[model samples]
Target chain A: MIPAGPAGAHVRHWQRFTFTERVMRSLFYIVVLIGIVWSLQSIEIIPEFLYDAPQQTADLFVRMWPIDWGWYPKVVHAALMETLHTATLGTILAVAMATPVALLVARNVTRSVLLNSIGRFILVATRSVHAMIWALFFVAVFGPGALAGTLAIAVHSIGFTGKFLSEAIEEAKPGPIEALKAAGAPPLAVLIKGIWPQVKPAFLALAMFRWDINVRESAVLGLVGGGGLGMALDTALSNLYWDQAGLVLAVIFGIVIVAEIATSWARSRII
Target chain B: MDASAPIKPPVDDAGVDRTLIIRSLTKAYRAGQPVLKNVSLKVEGRGMTAIIGPSGTGKSTLIRCINRLVDPTAGEILFLDQDIAKLNGRALRQMRRRIGMVFQEYNLVERLSVIENVLTGRLGYVPVWRAWLRRFKARDIERAFQLLDAVGLGALATQRADQLSGGQRQRVGIARALMQEPDLILADEPTSSLDPKTSVEIMELIAKRAGERDIPVIVNIHNVALARRFADRVVGMSKGEIVFDGPPRDLEDSHLLQIYGGEGWLE
Candidate 1:
């Protein structure tokens, strides 16, 4: 950065931070440094295992190579269909359940303080816990299967979709709503006819983005034996069949790519 | 008349046909300071009545109060043999269907097509499910198209509202209000956002519509010239109170001075 001669000679540097901002910046770095150290200590990092990981991974891959084409049919039958079904069903259910909650939480739509706070609380509570933890809860409740996987993803989605969608509704233009209500449209009608049009494009984008995330999340719900590609991968890993595990991972990757493309296409069309 | 009575549809008394009767209406957005203070006016049958005042003098508040958009702190708004001040829920909705409102901003849903916005005026009369599906009766669709044609946007019916010019959008707004098939119309400075020429055109259109219907129109306007030209009666307000109430021909510089204050602007 060059100092512009006498023109700005008497002027102080514009890049200077305020007193509080300077203090906050220093404090943030210190807190992050402390967190990293604490996490490493708490997890009991094994230096020896970490050092050997790369070598072990390379050796395993070498033995598993020569393309396990025979394992492709097994992977497709075992987990591909289940993975797709779980994600699609979970996303649909989650969006459906989130719709009412989103409306109640939107400040413009909902005037009640209690209801708005309750809606916010549900979103916060659900979102704070990840899909993995939700899978564990449903696995224990439903005895572990595709049912548990679907329910887990759906529950987490309620929080995810609700938070974004409600904000969109709140930020929507109030002009159309006033026009509709003045014409004697009811509250529900105001939502569907007046508010819906304003938020449809934004909501479509948000839902499609969430659906893509769910596809990735549902693939691994089977780690807890909820039944998908993750469960098949787990089985192959346990028996030390690295080639079979590689095949299952490849299938999961293919499905995720396909889902991502489809969602992108759908989002563009609607928005 | 008792103010505390459970207000219902009023029974016809004597020979006078009152389309709307307002008595002692006041509004306060805050606790003690009222924006509209004890405003009372009556409209018999039809024709346009323009309310003119300085900015922040509660001209908009007065018109909004009649439709219960801004609930009056103390008032009785009798329209079509019913007390508008007391209706709630379904009853209020039913009453609103009979009244149409035009805003200064011309608040048509920008994402919707011109014709679709005109049809929105019938939203109050249709079932919720039917409205969601955009299913209007054949008659309503036909009327919506006719209104678009009347507004001279017949070819632009499929165009989005945001694509139209300010003048064109206001025309769509006027068409939307007429779509309600309302018994009364409340226009809140319907031309305030338009250019001078467009303003004149809008006022003329409104006068023509109200004249044809014989329904009363209570308009809150800022332009004295436009109001006088279009209104059957001109109402001048100052400091949230009516200062002048008579025909437009009777108003002069003295009345304008009193309503808006300061003599320099009159020249």
Candidate 2:
């Protein structure tokens, strides 16, 4: 029994979760723990390899030390150029392709439910498949070159760019659009003048972000014959040239850092 | 043939047929719940007619119905020799351009330059490519600058709309509305967002500019004092119906009580 102090208050209690909710959350954690243990038991890790991992890493680093500096001008240079070209060209092409799809996906822009669904389906299909798998497919069709790599990156990026762009478009303020409509501007004019200006900052930021990601992802596309730095690394590993592999890895790490810095600067400037 | 024959519009002292006649206009956002009910009124060709009412009394719906922004569920709105309720597509757009509206929020595109937002008023007259390229005709550009000067925002023409204060933004909104070279102006609570002094100034600017051009204005306002000071006539609304309509000199405490209902705040 609780003592009543005020007319409207007998007992005032608050909680983040109900009793049943807490119990369910505990059960979920328990199930997750059991699943992790089951997975560990099924994999049957070899204790010898696990224990030797640190030493093996140290040995690999020792072999990779004093990397092949001469390899930079010979094999890595052309492959690095090819990788950059693949990413840049793919991003440009994706921008061209994704703009229309983003328009279709934005509910305020495209009114038809069926068209929105189709646009969503396209985004899901492109994004669900990994860029490497796309590279493999394009390699089969195009017979392995920068073209296949470029195509793979472009197709995979359409979903990422389109999804974000459509969201930006949807988030644009409705007030200006309504004002333009009241002014009797045509539908296309409304979009170009009213909606486009509002979403321009977000659109530019998204493009820069996606391009940054594409640079990193396209680096590995050459492993599947997509023609980039990964091809050079693959060749070096097969021949057991740790020095050349080390050069490739160092170049990739440097390029990624550079790309990140450049994109972040550009994003700041744009917004 | 009679139906097709054009009827001559009734011209007042302003020598323009800016007459707006609404007959039984009704709007129901849903099936049996109406926001506006059987409203009928006639506006003259010149001077400000203020519609004063409490919030949610459909003053906005009444004004929006004139531009067909909110589609009316029933009745005929007769303006410029055509029934506004019956227009669609290109016809409706053409009609809307002739009537300028100022919003309570002063909804100028914030990212655009103040002058560019003013030029948007000419969108209905210009081609789409010209708008896209920002290659507005020389006359329109000149006129936009003149309007900015008229609104006392001449120096701020190049600035972005978001950088403006609330009053300045509303001034830009007025300039944009005037840029349409409209026959009629509908101001739905234009001064509601500004301070007391700014509110009086905005009302003065609207009255002066629209009066100079003989463009009749219909303003919806909450401040009865501002309405009385600027509006030649006042129409009062309560619960989706016009409860009173008369000259401001004739409005009294009795009418205010009827319009706002249960108001100790009328002092």
Candidate 3:
């Protein structure tokens, strides 16, 4: 063992690895960097546009201003209302569906391995895919309306709410469940009396949060012919009515801000 | 005979068979290392029997075995002539309703109101679907209110369980146990989480209630003084076997040394 002056003296003092390791790592990084550059180049991305972005944005805003204030009464009566309808309907239906699924997915509550895994896989699958794709699928099947938008949001909510609510169910206090069981409460009774009450606050909070997100997401679903304000925005942009599109953006911004405030306030009070 | 007097066979319902018989009960969480080693004890109708031992001596397990909460590895627990150890499904559920348990932790559903937690004790008697609608029978609700009053929590019935102090919560726990109208009550160190005064109060409540109802109670107690004070019979265990079984007056310091395995604490 004492044969060497220092075991790693041959390696450079500044380097953490041997020469071969250093060369191989540097070469690997160089290849990765070149690959990223090549991919960016292929996409025809203009890095220089970053400098001109502010100016272009300002010009776009100028075009969008001079509010289509008169057109608001006409659009608000139908499209904006439809967007709200889609979000509310989707949230109601999703919560109805997610309650049982969440119980089945929670490791502490679920009885069977096969059933639990299937529930987990379904949640993971739905969560992994984007809502836009769900909208497209529903649109293709249902022929593009508030129905498509509602179904899309509903399906996505199952993933979001199911995963979060199941975790809350799992984290529920075991003492209460044990007490309930010791009282000879049946399985269903135990769920209602023991588990549900403990997780209810968290589930309510998540449900409201999902509804908030759905309102925003539903607003844009119309771009892909699902319905709502996105359709109105798409139409205005296509017809070169920049002022109308600007009004739609303003409405969306206003609604989202209000919804966030409302949801958080409600969550605080309820929880 | 009075017209309202119910017809009955020539037998005493007051002294009816509420006796619990256990034959060679054994339990092991893992393969070979057993927690209870072929233990057997019988509890007669009514009054309190306390099991006292050092920590981890399978006292809780033995109490749980009577209710079939922890399955005995090899045993027969005969409650009212039926072998509960062999029962399953609906039969087991029927058995469990008659056996109430109190935990070391009061284990109240903290978010629920005191009255609602008390009503959960009737879950076995009511259909599951009825609970979904919050539809407890009127009599059960009225009885729950009575139990709350009996437990000295009548004013706090509407309060959330977590809002109460430790003793108040344990009072609710006792009310819940009584609500079951159980034939046997298992108190698994019911006073462990309580202060000394509260512990004595809880024991008195358990003993008084079981006496009123003529239901036998098995308690896994840590405090020997409380055991001697409340328990009609004291069973001592060491290394998962019952080493002493007699009336409370006979549980001498020498037996404590044998059961708890130390001489210094006796002083």
Candidate 4:
């Protein structure tokens, strides 16, 4: 028999390079090229602007710094509550609507391919429109209030929550459902007993996650006249009350932090 | 020793009075590729009737057809004189309450407590609101506890299903089935996931309890030895058709070869 070292070398010589390694190298080069392009675009080093450039942005930031400090308390109390209310209403309505829609969208759960396709199309339509644009549309219809913001957030969240919930439902073990069916349980019973148990925790966790995101989105809905803390922030900025705007920013930051912590705690308990 | 002994049969033959009848049952997932073709069999009201078959031979499909899990494309399934194939919605659910099923994987709701998982068997009997609220009647809870005790899982009532060992989970699964107070128990590869020792123990428990209750069991199994050990009658399937139907003693090596299609492994 040949020595172990020479035998290993012979084996190595016979082995061909894998397709995966070649693909990985190509991907690395493409990623580096894209990063360089993005960096150059971000710094405006390519002379792409036509008017009112990055200097205007810096000027606006400087002009919006010193806000009206005395207006802080009122702004924080009222606007903060509105933001929370929008998030609460939006998340609740979104979760309720998405629950049924997700059942339709999930391939394993939905028996009809046509229905599943329709459900997926609806989700795509809802998600393609950003929350801000949805807020603008709702403002056009509902005339600028928390209702508009709530509707905006609800529509956007339905897309996100429906997709996530459907994925969770699809990935659940098929064994329990089969067992239920064999036990002579009806379709609805199988869904309740087998599917619901597997998906409930994930659905709850997703709802909590959406609530946190909705709070942040609700704060900005006022910028598009959909009504919330964003309206106050926009007003302060337009009037050059930089100190009051600064205070509002601080309050929004605090609310986001608190919402994050609460959502995280709730998620931990559930999963 | 007396306490551990299997329950003795009473004079009343309530279990023997019931029967399941199937006539020309046929199931096709697609237009032409039938999983069960013109299959017809009857199960006696008591004792274990094991269905032995190779993989992809429609053994599961046959059991599923009995409960209408996969709707038969043609023919009739009569359970206690009712045309079970025609049942829909509430009628089907009510019928299902009396037919319990045990799975290969011990399909307990993993996040639920063993007792809570067992309580689900009562879903067909309990009102929807009651099930939602988990407010099963006091009698039902008592019965659930009793069944848990009978299945030897009394102490594991509060434990999450995923925490239990495979044998322990199967015990809980049996208890859950018993909680339904079903007239028939259908076990689909119930011991396929277990080791030989555990499989024997589980099969013994299933056979003993089912016998005591006088409830008939239609078990789909791959192991010929286990089937011979426990089953009163064996039904062998090959390529979606029943090739042999007889007592274990009558199931000769030639029949096994005919059913499974090779004699190389019989040695």
Candidate 5:
């Protein structure tokens, strides 16, 4: 009460400035810098050649219009099916491989520090190479086919699925595990009864999410000779058949949307 | 209260004496610092033995060590003439299946139905493929139903565990433990999360079940009143060491003061 004056007001002002005001100012500067960088990139000022690339892009888009409704049925029935099959086979193989690797990577489950570290490093190595690059490498090794694409997607999915599964396993409640141990449940029994129950919903959700992403990625893997709809789209684009390219893009988009909806519905039912 | 007063029932003395003999037990989380320091205490084969102490006194560690959950750094935990402390892998798992534990939080898998959680108690007994298939033996299922009924949770068996009240979940937890047909029951602060009334009910259930089965029970409890109310024998721990062991009737206010340290909380 004695210090309820201008001096106290000054102290309160400084306190406000040090915490809230300073943070606001820092955020403002970061936003402004990001905006500037984005503007430069968008206008192609940063990459001179991009600035001169508009005429070609516009021509491509103009040629893409004038609907290819005649071929829509075939694209949906065949190409979309191929895409789904690639995603399904890829995700199934990945989930199978990831299951054991995830257990080894999880620090809580693994017990051995060296083993967990090694498993994590392997996952990191697998994930480091992008799926498209993996597809290209596999295509070179096995020759251009759906197998190469499937293996590429599976390898990449393994890294992602294993990392997420391990995290889910690690974060599982310790209560059941402890209870299982006290019950004299074997390590395998504990994993089955204690860990699996807690992580099942999350694991399934992650796997579904990976499958959704794989559907989108599998279409792209074909661009690198891993055969699928992306191969059709790439060939159409290369031949300047913009209407066919547009059809392929629409089909890919439709498949992705459908997969996302289906996976989301499935995930909701699990939990 | 006399520190040397007999705690166990007279009939237990003459029967096939089933006692847990813990000798020179020690546990340390870190290399230099020990959580349980050369702790050793015998538990009678029948009735409830409550280990009462203040927080951080290794009460939970001692109970966990009985089934090798905490894994003692040193000592022999001889249960039925077998050194559980030295057992590993399959032997350890076989030993664990014979002992049951209830937790303070109930620890039921929230996503699982109550019946599924109860069946988990039989996981060690059932084959892995059978468990994976959710094909519990008909007898086991019938026994689980009976146990759920005994716990007054038969009606709620189909509900998910997360849907139950705290007291109800603890009841399910009890049913799950009892399903194991354990030789000994370990309850670590099982009722600490419940209201006073619920706590009493849970403790009464634990005491009654253990008594009916003539199974030994080791409970780590912070509430001295609760411990005194249910415990046949009271083992008072302080700073990872047993300071007093005797009948609950013999645990005087002075002993409580020693076990918990300071008399400010005492009425």
Candidate 6:
């Protein structure tokens, strides 16, 4: 209702937040500040190490000034290829595994509450554990090979890919599905002709994005004894070959940039 | 309105019982409050039957109930020698194949090409693998294109459904409905989203095409004038009950007042 002032004068009043809301917001900000201060007090810092951090960083960079380009042909080349394969294969595996999980998780697609919960459980379980931790677990099982890295990437990606794909499925317009159902199309037919077409672009775009992220994640998998360029870097660092380690870092950085650019371009084309 | 007049069911030239009988149909989304209150309607074998009423009068619900899209809480929907309300699973799907439906929003799959959307009408009849492979039968493809041509959309066969204008999408929707080789058609507010000119054109297309095929069409329409122009029979509903049932020429202003509950909008 519009409020009127005395003597029939027009009165307009607008505030984004009510007084109670403003008070609650102020309380929230104070609590956040207290939490930050409490956390700062808990994590102890060494004053000597903190003071010389810049100097230490400069010394390390100086030791790695001359990158050993010669290391590329001997070891980095094969490891780089292995990293790409892990990312690519892992993504394909993740997409394949996540498709059914996504279907189950989407409320519109799977009406059963039990199935949705199971799907949700799987998504949360796979996603809660970081890729590096997953790599360590798989490396223990697979004995520190490329298989471990691929498995790690795929498992970690299931939660991400399935979540997005299920969201896409749920967001699909129901009009076409209803139209097809009215035409007496079978359940499978409706899914193919109605839902698939609607979600295909989003599916492809998400898959590409997952693959891009997987590439970067897979690159570091070897640090945990899963196979990739990180293994080569591990070897160089263990052997005190700073120049070789620098070359591996440079290569990884370059490849990540390339993967980002390529995936963005491909996503644009698909969407 | 002499609404107590008995409806004489008509048979088509093929001697098929195309009459759709609804007896005391009632629907309640919630337990006690009914959206349709003991509604009953009879759609004869041929020509257009328009259900006209104000919004939320169960016009759309009544049409959907015939094909079992919206299940009636109580009543019988007798069509084609079967009780549509009781059919389940495969039996229900088989019954639905003979009934085609058009929508207010022209619900074509937005990413699918025009011809594919039209072919969706055949998805019920074709094998699932055929739809998956885009390997529809030769005759079905020919007929889809022919129907598209009939709707003046032959040139836009390969275009995505989302790329078309509202009128064009509704044309595709009509073509898709016709492609089913249906015995009956149900259209729920098919032209409510179109402009006046396009609305008229769409109504004309529905009437003409269904007329040529001798298929009975029950359309839920808000535009009383379009219903009068295109429908052979008019069913006026108010508060979930059939208030008037007669020919378009006999739909007087008094009937409109009774159905819509206001004399102000009559002008």
Badly placed stretches (over 4 Å) of model 6 are A1-34, B1-15
- Across A81-122, the per-residue lDDT of candidate 6 in tens digits comes to 999999999999999999999999999989999999999999
Worst 10 residues of 1 chain B by lDDT: B9-18
The C-alpha stretches of model 1 lying farther than 4 A from their native spots are: A1-35, B1-18
lDDT by residue (tens digit), candidate 4, A45-159: 5454545578777775676566556686676678788889999999999999888889999989888999998999888888889999999999999899899999999999889
Q: Model 2 Cα RMSD, Å?
A: 3.2
* lDDT (10s digit) by residue, model 2, range B1-267: 144444445454434577899999999999798889999999987899999999999999999999998999999999876899999999999988889989999999999999999999888778999999999999999999999999999999999999999999999999988998888899999999999999999999999999988899999999999999999999999988999999999999999999999868876
- Ranking by DockQ, best first? 6, 2, 1, 3, 5, 4
| Model 4 pairs whose backbones collide | A66-A242, A66-A243, A67-A242, A67-A243, A67-A244, A68-A243, A68-A244
DockQ scores of the candidates: 0.70, 0.71, 0.65, 0.42, 0.58, 0.74
Q: In candidate 2, residue A129 scores what lDDT?
A: 91
RMSD of each: 4.9, 3.2, 4.7, 6.5, 5.4, 4.8
lDDT of 1 by residue, A111-138 (tens): 9999999999999898899999999999
Clashes of each: 0, 0, 0, 7, 3, 0
Q: Is the docking of candidate 4 incorrect, acceptable, medium or high quality?
A: acceptable
Model 2 chain A lDDT-worst window of ten: A1-10
**In order, what lDDT does every prediction score?**
0.87, 0.92, 0.88, 0.85, 0.86, 0.93
Error of 6 at B89 (Å): 1.5
Instruction: Report lDDT (Cα) of residue A42, candidate 1.
Output: 100
Question: Which ten contiguous residues of candidate 6 chain A have the minimum total lDDT?
Answer: A1-10
- Scored by TM-score, the top model is 2
- Location of the lowest summed lDDT over 10 successive residues in candidate 2 chain B: B1-10
What lDDT does candidate 3 reach at residue A210? 94
**Between candidates 2 and 4, the lDDT winner:** 2
The pairs that clash in candidate 6 are none
Residue-level lDDT of model 3, residues A92-166, one tens digit each, is 888888878888899889879999988988788877878789999999999989999999989888888899989
Q: What would the per-residue lDDT of candidate 3 be over residues B1-267, giving only the tens digit for each residue?
A: 333455333212443477788889999999799999999888886789999999999999898887777888999999865898998877887788888888899999999999999999998889987877889999999999999999899999999999999999988998898899888899999999999999999999989977878888899998999999999999999989999999999999899999998787788
